[model samples]
Target: MSADILNSLARRVGDGVAAVRPAAAMADSEATDPVEAVATALLGYVSEPGDGVLGRLVGALGASGMATALLEGRSGRDIAGQAVTGLGPADAPSGREVTAGLARWGPRLEEDAFARSIAQAARVGARLLLPGDGDWPEGLDDLGVHAPLSLWVRGRPSALAERPSLALVGARAATGYGEHVAVEAAAGLVDRGLAVVSGGAYGIDGTAHRAALAAAGTTVAFLAGGVDRFYPAGHEGLLGRIVETGAVVSELACGAAPTRWRFLQRNRLIAAASDATVVLEAGMRSGSLNTAGHAAALGRPLGAVPGPVTSPASAGCHRLLREFDAVCVTDAAQMAELVASVGGGVGGSGDGDDDAMTGAPPPRRLEMLSSAERRVLDALGTRRSRPIGDLVRDTGLTPGAVMGALGALDATGLAARSGEGWVRRPPDEASVRPGSWS
Candidate 1:
C-alpha cells in the first residue's frame, strides 16, 4: 500500500484522501512512509523542472500533502495557502501561477507512474537520491525553487562529490583544438582531486568524460532525459562505461522522454552540481552559455577558454569572457584554479539564505517531517506488527505522538493497522529495494 494511493487516484479526482500536513515529517520519514518517497517522485513527474510554483508548494505542504492536494483537485489558491501557513508568503506562488502550474502538471500526472518508474530504474540498477540523503549533492541547494527535487543516478552516487567537481561544457560540434583542451583539462582536474562533470553530449562533453575516464578519474554526466535511455543514442556504450566507473544522472523519471526545455533546464543542474563551470569551446549561441549563466547566477566560479578569433566555434567562450565576466582559462591548471577560487564548495551549498529572486529556501528546506512522525514510522515494521505500547517504549515518543503519527501514516498509506497493532505498507514489503527507489 505504499504508493497505492497515487495509483488508485489514476481515475479519481479529489476527496482529500491523504492527510495534508507539513513536509518536515516526510523528510525525516526515510524508512517510515514509503509512499512519501513515491509522493515526492510523483510531484516531479507531474510538474516540469524549475517550476517555482510547484517547487515552493511542495516545500510548504510536504510532498505527501502536496501530492494529496493535487490528487484531490484542490485549487491553486487553496494549495498556495499551505505556503502562507508554513513558510509565509515570501515565495508562495500566485494563485494564477499555481493554477497554471496545475494545468501544466495535470496531463502529465499518470497512474502508477511512480511504480513503473521505480521498477524500470531497478532493472537498470539506478538509485533515487532525495534532497537530504547522504549521497545527495548538496550544492544543488543553491538553486532554491529551481533545484531538482530528486536525482536518478545510474552509477556510483559517490561520483557526485568524490571531490569538488568542475563542469566542462561547450558546443557539441567541438573543434580538434577544443577537444584537445577538454581532454587535457579533464585529466588534469582529475589528477588535482576534482571530479569532472558534463552533459553526455558529443564533442566537448563526450571528450571530457572520456578523458576523465581514461585517466581513471571520477566523472558524472547529467542527462536531460531519464538515465534509463542514455540520450543521443550513440553514447550508449560511453554511458554504460560511466555506470561502471562513475555516474550518469537525471532529474526526469525513468521512461520520460527528453525535450528542449529539459535540456536547457538540465544545464542549470550541470552548473549547480559542480564547484565551477568552464566553457571549453562554444559558438556564439552555444548552449554552454546557458550553463555558464547558471554558474554565475549560483555564484559558482565560471571560466572560458580562449581560442583563435577567426574560429566561430570559440565565439561563445570569448563572449562569456568578455560579457559574462567569466574567467579566462586555457589550461587545466587555470580551470583547477577556478574551483580553488571558490573554496571548492560543490553545488554552492552556502549558508541558509533564501533566494533573492524566487524566495526559495535553502536545499531540502521544502522536505520535512514532524519528529513524532519520524519516531512513530521508525517503530513500525512492514511484516511484523507492533502495538502502541511497544512503539512508545522502543521510540521513546509519547503515546499521543505515536498515535498521531500512526493515524497520519495510516491515512497516507505509510502504515496500517495489523491484526494486533500496526505495520508498515508494501513499499519495502517483499521488495529487494525500498519503494522510494522507484
Candidate 2:
C-alpha cells in the first residue's frame, strides 16, 4: 500500500515543519506534521475535487511525493508511469488522460496561492485533517479515488466524526412547504442524536442547519468554496454560528471561489459523509437530486418528502420517489426510520435487524433515471398523446431538454412515439398493475 511513500512523506513533512518552527514547540500544539499539511494545502490549490488522476497518483506516491513531482514540473506521462508501477495494471490512468489533467492543473499552480491558503487557515484557527487524522470522516473513504486530498475545518471536528450523520438537501428556491419540512426533518434527526449535514446554500440547506442548531444538535456544512470565504454572502451570520457550534468544512483551500462545477462535485461529499440523504423539496432540475443520486450510487439509503403534485418545487422529490426508489418520508419519525434501517440499529433496537423484527419490506430497484427523463415521463398521459411543445410547457422544461428526455425514454421502452405524438407504455407483463391511474 505504498508504505515507503507514506513514511517518507511523514518524515519530510516533519522535517519541513521543524525547519519552519521549533520542533519542540510545534510538537505540542499541532495535530499534523507541518510539511504534509503544506503539501496537501498546495494540492487543493491546483487540483479539483474528484480528480481521479490526482487521487490515484497520491495513493501510489503519497501526498509528499506527488507534490514534489508536480512542483518540479514533471510531465503527466512520467507521473502516470510511476503510478502504474505501484498500482494494479487495470487501475492505472491512461497517459492521455493524465496529460490532459496535468494541463488543467498547471495553470492553477502558484506557490503564493498555496502560502496564502495556509496562512489564512492559521489566522482563522482552522485545522488541516489528512487521511489518517483522528477527526477525518471515514465515510469519505467510500468514495475511493474521488475522496478529498485533505479537509480544511473550522469548529469541532468531532461534529463530523463522532456521530451518525444525515444529509438534508433541496432547492435553493425552496417554497414554504419545503422549508417547513426541512426544519422539521433537521430538528427531528437531531433529537434522534444524529448530526445533520448539508451544503451551506439558502432555502432548504440553510433551514436545515438553522433547525439543527436551534435544537442544540450537531450539524456540519460542506462548502463548495473555501471555508475562508463563505458563498451566498447572505449566510455569513448563519455560517458564523455554524463555526462556533458545529463545523464548516471544505475540500478547497482558503482563497478558492465557488464555481458551478465545484458545487456539483461538492454534492458527493455531502452524500459520502452521511449515513443517509433526504430531499425535502426540489424542482426537477434542483441540485439536491444530484446529492440523492450520489447517495444511491454509494449504496446509502435515500429518502424524499412528498409534496403537492401541483407544486413544481417538489417535482424532484416526486421523481426520486417514483423512479429512483427513494423511500417516502413525511416527518422526523420516518426520517429516523430510514437512518435506522441503513445504520443496522438505532437507540436500543436489538441487533440492528429491526426490519426483520418489524417485517418491513426490503428496498426495491437499486437504480433510477435522471430527473429530466422522469419529468418527461411524468408529463405524458397514460392513454393520450402529447407533442413535444405541449410537454415543454407542462413540464416547464426547455424544448431541447424535453426532446432529449423523450428520446431517452423511448429508447428505454418507457415511452413510445404514436401517430399523434407520444404516449406512456403499458406496464410490463411481469409486474403487478395498479387498480387505476389518477
Candidate 3:
C-alpha cells in the first residue's frame, strides 16, 4: 500500500471541496447539487502552498485536462489548483477568497456530507479503498476526474487488484437469452479463476451472480445505491448469496437510493474498476452503453455479446460492435481470452482457471437423458424445489411430460416427490428424512 497515494487523494479531494466552499454553503442552505458544490470547493485547495499557484494551476488543467495529467505523473495538487485558476476571475476563486474561506469553513468541509458518506460506508462491512491502497486497481486511476475518491467494498478487498475482473452489464429487463449468456459467461469466467463483477441489478446481473455461486466461484457485484439496499427487489436472494460467497460493493454509502445521476456515475465505477466490461444485452438506449463508453474512453478492454438481430434488447450491443469498436464475444472462454490479451496485460490465472463452468463432468453416453429427463434436471439444477405446476411452467412442457420426467427422476433416485413439493434428493440420503422436505 502506498500511503503517499492515499494522502495525495485525501488532500486532492479535500481541496476540491474547499474550492467550491461558497457554492457548497449555498447549496446546503438552498438544497442543490451538494456533490457538485463540494467538487467546486476543492478547486483552489489543490494548489501548491503559495498565493498565485491556484491561478497558474487552473490554466494548465484546462489546457491539458488536469485529471488525465494527474494520472500521467503530474502532481495532483499542483494540477488541480492551477487548472481552476486558468479560467480567470469569472470562473475561479481569487486567492484571497480561497484563503479566507479556507480559514472559516475548512473544518466544515472535513465534516461535510461527503465525508459522512465515507464514514457511513465504513460503518458497514465496507472498507474505504483510497488510491495507493493495496486493493486499489491502478488501472482505475485512468479515469482521471471521474475516478472515485474511495471505493466502498465488502469481501476480499484484495480481489479489486489481485484478480482479473470482468464487468458483465445488461438491461434490468433481460430476456431468457440474455440471462443464459450472463450465467454461462459468469460461470466460465469463474471457472477460469477470474472474479466476475456486475451491477447486481436484476435479470442478467442476478443470473450472473447465481451462476458464479453455483460454480462455487468468487463474484462481486457493484451497486449504484448501497450494500444494504438491493435494487429491482427481485434479486435480494441472489444478492445475499453474493455477499456470502464473494462481495457486494458500492461507491456510495448506505441509505443512498439509486438515483439517475448515481446510476450514470455507477457506470464509471464498473468500467474503471474492471479489467474488461462486457455488455450482454442492452436495449437501443440501454444505460449499459454508458458503462461501455466509459470503458472505451479509459482504453479498457470492452466486449459485447451478440444477440438476435430481432431482439431490441440486443440493439445496444450491436451498436457497440458497429460504432464503438468493441469485441464481439460468444462465450466465457472467448471473453476471458479477449480481455486477457486485448489490453496488453495478462489476465489473472489461478485454481479455477481450468475448472469447467458446469462444475460437473460432461454428460457421458449414459448420463445423457431424454428431453423430458433433461427438462426435469434443468429445473432441479436451477431451483432445488418446485411444485408440479411450477415445473410445468418453467420447462414449458405439458403436465404429462413433467409427470413422466419426475417419475423417471424418482425411480432413478435423483429426485423425490413430497407433500411440500418436488425436490432434488440429497446424494447420500437413503430415504427422505423426516421434515427434510419441510
Best by TM-score: 2
Every model's TM-score: 0.73, 0.74, 0.56
Instruction: Give lDDT tens digits, candidate 1, residues 373-422.
Output: 64466557789989887776444444665788889878767789988899
Number of the candidate with higher TM-score, 2 or 3: 2
Report backbone clashes per prediction. 10, 1, 19
lDDT minimum window of 10 residues, candidate 2: 351-360
Q: Residue 400 error for model 1, in Å?
A: 48
Q: Which candidate is the best by lDDT?
A: 2
Candidate lDDT scores, in order, read 0.73, 0.74, 0.59
Off by over 4 Å in 3: 1-123, 343-438
When summed lDDT is taken over every stretch of 10 residues in candidate 1, the lowest stretch is: 358-367
Give the per-residue lDDT digits (tens) of candidate 3, residues 1-438.
333433444564453333322232233232233232333223312211112333333344431243234323444444445546656556554444434323322222222454545444445555544454555667767655345544556666666675677888888778999998887888888877777777877667778878888988778887766665676577877877777767777665445556443555566677777888898988765667777877887777888999999988898889889988889888887789766785434444433320011111111211334645755655664245688766654443456667888888788777886666788764333432211000
Model 1 clashing-pair count: 10
Give candidate 1's error at residue 171 in angstroms. 0.6
Clashing pairs in 2: 344-352
| Native-referenced Cα lDDT, model 1 | 0.73
